[model samples]
Target chain A: MLLQINDVNKQYTNNKVTNTVLDHVSVSVKEGEFISILGPSGCGKSTLLSMVAGLVKPTSGTIMLDGQPIQKPGKDRGMVFQQSALFPWLNVEENVMFPFKKEMNKQEALQKAKHYLQMVQLSNYGKHYPHELSGGMQQRVAIARAFTMDPKVLLMDEPFGALDEQTRTRMHGELERIWLDTKKTVLFVTHSISESIKLSERIIVMGTRPGRIIADIPVTLPRPRRFDAPETIQLEKQINHLLKEEIDKVVKEELSYAENR
Target chain B: MQRIGKQLVFFVGLVIAWELIVRAGGWTPDVMPKPTDVWEAMKRGFSDRTLVYDLQASFTRLFIGLVISLALGTALGILLAKSKTADDTLGALILALQSVPSIVWLPLAIMWFGLNEKAVIFIVVLGGTLVMTINMRMGIKNVPPLYIRAAETMGSKGIDQFIRVILPASVPYAVTGMRLAWAFAWRALMAAEILSTGPGLGYTLKYASDFGDMSLVIAVMILIGVIGSIVDLLLFQRVERNVMKRWGLETN
Candidate 1:
């Protein structure tokens, strides 16, 4: 396993109430595998990703990357947040070069940034500020930035959730192309079932509120999967059925909790 | 071009209004000099070389005091923001001193530094430091945690993280502090000169006031206001706008 998350748990305390967000979850990822964690909102999918990225500590259990225990955020685990999160002060080139401080000199960093920017088809926008770019472009810049670090794992949390439908679809295609080109391990978290089905080699369906994995479905679809393929459609429907059942359970539980309170 | 035209029209209107008000109020030469009288007085001062000396003195004091305050205040503010011990020990004392008017410290400053350039510079520094410290602390605190984490992930830590990531990111806030500090120092220098009777614009105003030459006083006041506005608009505002534009902080 390139990555191992064993019996991981996380809790948050507000006022006096301790809310358990993740409970005894374990996941293993092979190198260059694309995996998606699918769940309802507030199912702690993003929290799980944060824990894996070492942005937050797991309440119990452990996460290891390449046999080393993860303790803090490192360049080995590059993260792309739901929001663009680009430093407003930095232009596109600078933002892309942000994580390359130790690996490259100024000239080399600039060259690498240009290379990645060209890969993202943003070579002309090297001097453009974040605000000058559209939402999709900004997110692309963010994607370029993460990839430029050459991280062992690429962790994405709803990176395209805010984009429009057309833009999202186009980005999905672009992302798939990038994934094929780079072959970096990706652990993506999303509420969109179709998005997960469309992107990942495996989809882990999670139940809401004290999130637990309800289904781990492997997608055996061929690489460079087409959006309108018959096989893709059949697999998506099967996953959708499982997801609906889990989502119904979540709604019922939420209603009961709200009524009790 | 349209905006500039509107601004020009507004400025001309303001001068016309001022001239009309002076004429309507039946102001004497000693009470409120006419705009023309003040203009003539300014021309005379320019020709005599006294105004140049006074302007140079005031500007030198302002620049020196501003530089010192900016350096010291930024250092102290960062320390306060980062260190609990420093914040707890000095926060209240700094707040108290800031609230007390800069003029109130004049006598003490004079006593400590004597009636020299140091005394005037001391007042300007005291006046400017507090606002700079407060603004800089807020700036540091407001830097996004994600950026800091991002830097750490790239092997940046401690002072390297601060200087490379944190400081450059907080340029807007620091510039704001510098602008505020300039205004405060400018006001304090005028007051310091008035009290200390130093060879500056404020002292020139005071000297004119003592001789009942209200025209010269009015001319000095106009000069001070013009210079202050020019510094803010042309220098500080230009730099701030350029930085913000490069940073994408401005919307349009």
Candidate 2:
């Protein structure tokens, strides 16, 4: 295992009110495996991903990367946020080169930035600022910046959640190509069952109410899974059925609370 | 370009109206000098080196006062932003002091520094530091937490985070603060120069008014306005526009 998250639990406390966000969740990821933690909203899926990134602390258990305990955020794990958190002050090339500060000279960093920007097909936008780019282009610059750091793992939290349907579908293909080329370990979190099925080798289905893993289904089908493929359709339907129950529970809880109020 | 053209037309119209009014009203030079009379006075003062001396003197005091306030106020602002204890104890007191006008500090300034350049500089610094501190606090507070988290994952930590992430993100706010401070310090310098005997535009205005030299007084006032506008256009506004454009803060 390249990364191990064993019996991890997380609780958040505010004003003497304690909420258990995750409960006894355990997961193991291999060096080059692509996994998706698929669930509905409020299932603590994002929280779990944040914990692995070392941005949040788990209440119990441990998360180890490369046999070392994850204590704080480092260059080892890179993250792609849902909203493309590119630094607005830096242009595309400068933003990609930012993490290379003090690690190499300016000329070498520029060269490396050029390489990654080319990888993302954004070499023409080296001098353009973030505001000048479209949403998809900005996200591309963010991906280039993250890959330029050459982290051990890439954690994406619904990286295409904000895009329209057509752009989302196109980005899925682009992301798959990038993953294939890099062959890096990835832990993706998303609410879209079809997206998870198309992208991940294994999908961890989670349930709400003190969130925990309910199923771990493997997609044994070959790469470049087509939307019309029988295996892809079957897995999507199965995961949708598993998740519908959890989503209904949430809806009912909210409805009852609203009625009482 | 359109804005400049309109401004030029309005300015020339105003000057022509002033000249016509002074001539038609039959007002003596002591009451209100004609626009051309004031322009001639300006040329004469510049030739005699009196206007240059006063401008240099006033600008030196303004520059020194600005540097001092910028350093002290920025440090104090960072302290207030970063520390809970300091903000709780001293923040309210600082706000109270700032609420009182900078002119109100004149009596105390005179008592402390006693009718010297120090007195004028002291008041100018007082006028600026409070506004700078307030703006710095707002700037630092407004820096998004997302930027910090992103920088941390890039291997920046502790002081490196503060210097690189926090500081650059707060610059837009700081620039706004500096613009407001410049306006306040300019007014405070004038008030101080008028009260204390000094070789500045304010002092020249006072001396000319006492002698009923209205043309000289009007010329000095116009010079003050011109210099202030030039600094704002060339220095403050240009920097602010560049920063805002780069940061994507500007809308259309």
Q: Could you give candidate 2's per-residue lDDT for residues A221-256 as a string of tens digits?
A: 888889999878888888989998998888899999
Worst 10 residues of 2 chain B by lDDT: B189-198
Best by lDDT: 2
Model 1's alpha-carbon lDDT is 0.88
DockQ of each: 0.46, 0.62
**Residues B1-252, candidate 2, lDDT per residue (tens digit)?**
999999999999999999999899999999989999999999998999998999999999999999998887898889889988888877787899888888788888889988889989999999899899988988988898888878887888889889878888999989988988898899889888887776999999999889999999999999989888888889999999988987878989
Q: Which stretches of candidate 2 lie over 4 Å from their true place?
A: none
**Candidate 1 chain B worst ten-residue window by lDDT:** B147-156
Error of 2 at B4 (Å): 2.6
Per-residue lDDT of candidate 1, residues B52-79 (tens digit): 9999999999999999999988998898
